[model samples]
Target chain A: MTAVQIIDDLVARPGEGKALLDAYMADYAPGARARGMVLDRVLVSPPLWMDDQPNTLTIVWNVEGAAGWWGMRLAAGADPSATAFWETAGARLVSRARRFAAAPEDVETLCNG
Target chain B: MAKFTALITLQPGADRDAFARNIGDATLAQPTLPGVFDGGDLILHRQVANEAVPSDAAIAHIDSAVYEPIGGGAHEPGLRNGVYRCLLLAVKPGTPEATVRQFESETLAMPHYIGTIRNWRLSRVTKASGARVWTHVWEQEYADIGGLLGPYMTNPYHWARVDRWFDPECPEWIVDTRLCHSFCAFERSVLNP
Candidate 1:
């Protein structure tokens, strides 16, 4: 079966790495799960906390396939919880981006079907 | 040179007969826009049906301002007393002019994808005199309410392709979230002279 991956690249303001992650777990993750997205893992770059330097948070998520991908987007795109989380989290973040991807071998099934 | 449309929502138990009398007596400028309508600068439409699809309550009244058509206007003879839908929206401030034009072009492409629309017009608002500063007015005529709530809403082009401009989660999103999605009944073809 084909699968789709969603990655969120977020940079937290200096001294805000931990606080932003905590807030994401508390506010954003629940809504994401309800929208059919499964959290895979989260990674922080530079491997250490810094008071004066920003930290990059990479969040990985998974869905079944193209149908699942679109379903998640349609739900999340209108979800007020998602909007509220980002608006409120804006204070603790420098920048954020969401990316979609799939495994190399499953690309054909994901795109064609 | 300018197109205007107003979305009016009545209070939950407001008196309709009194409001109709006042609106009928209201003065309006002469309409310069090409289209078939009774003499007036603004045409009043009371919604026959309304439902909130994604968000916000359905508007009860629509005040469409007169103007010369700028870009798109269409009509199909013999389609009358049908659904006339209008969308009032604002492009967020600070979005590049080029991006706004792109969004406009994308919107104008809807007829190509959905064949149910009988008449349509897309115009930019020139005046800002309302509670919300709306930037655009997108109007369409349909054979029935099902034409709008069914194929138009379910088309992939609508939800998948063009919706990104309105979807807050999209990076390409430039439109404000507050929008007036309202429709009403019309006797004559509004997009034809």
Candidate 2:
């Protein structure tokens, strides 16, 4: 089964939304490549309605398994330098939701199709 | 609270590069305001799919947070707006109402935003396989979603220019309001410390 999580109440900063997302992606890409995790599509778009909310950016990519996802996170937080970048960049760490499953196909077609 | 999963969808033929760029721009544009907290992006891909389904599409996850009421205002922005939607995935299943309410208020009033707006849903998958899948859905809508993009996409003089891209006054449904679909399979994993 697929799990869905929505992180709302995002701060209303001026340019932080785009800045944080860019920094995180730049930091995440290299490690994913090294692990044989292919770089996939990253989508950034404005909210359809709410004016006083943070903008949204949705990313899709592929990897082998749970280990692959963990490996990518480890790479992002691996070095002190990278950790510092994440910290100083000031990208607010909002809520995160994770679902356990064997594969993407086991979830549903809304995200995969 | 027990963490739940969320699935996001993009319009057909949506540009990935532009999507990333827009998210980056919106995040960067946030720090200029008050009551802002943190933000980050997550790139999700389809590792598997049912028969006859394409596994190439990507899903982008961009998130941020804000502080509780600014200056002790009466209007709780988070709950009124939809911030509670985020909290639903955070707090333990048995959290108290006060805490939940607090999170909700902060979410509604947060100031950051993107250029365009689209519909999003929160759900839990109850079943899955190559042939069949099931999910419980929750959807949210914001009236000012386009305000972030309005400054850039529309001319200053026009009040209803969005119709140029698609009709605005016809009351036609432009964005999908429901979160039901069986297009892809998703899995979740935790990031290591």
lDDT at A112, model 1: 39
TM-score of chain A of 1: 0.94
TM-score of decoy 2: 0.26
- State the fraction of real interface contacts model 2 keeps: 0.00
lDDT of 2 by residue, A3-76 (tens): 22111122323445666566656774464466445645555556432344555555554654333434443454
Q: What's the lDDT for all of these models?
A: 0.67, 0.30
Q: Which candidate leads in TM-score?
A: 1
By summed lDDT, which 10 consecutive residues of candidate 1 chain B come out lowest?
Answer: B47-56
Give the lDDT of residue B102 in candidate 1. 92
lDDT of 1 by residue, B1-193 (tens): 4444444444456553444345542211111122322212223432211111112233244434333344674648657767777776778999999998899899888888777777887877655434446778788888887777767775556654677788777567888776666665556655552
Instruction: Evaluate chain B of model 2: give its TM-score.
Output: 0.20
**Candidate 1 deviant stretches above 4 angstroms:** A1-27, A36-81, A84-113, B17-68
Evaluate candidate 2 and give its CAPRI docking class based on DockQ: incorrect
Model 1 per-residue lDDT tens digits across residues A55-103: 9999999987756766887688678888888889889989987776778
lDDT string for model 2 (B13-71, tens) is 66544544444312111111111111112222221221121233443332212112121
Of the true interface contacts, the fraction found in model 1 is 0.12
- Model 1: TM-score for chain B: 0.74
> CA lDDT of A3 in candidate 1?
66
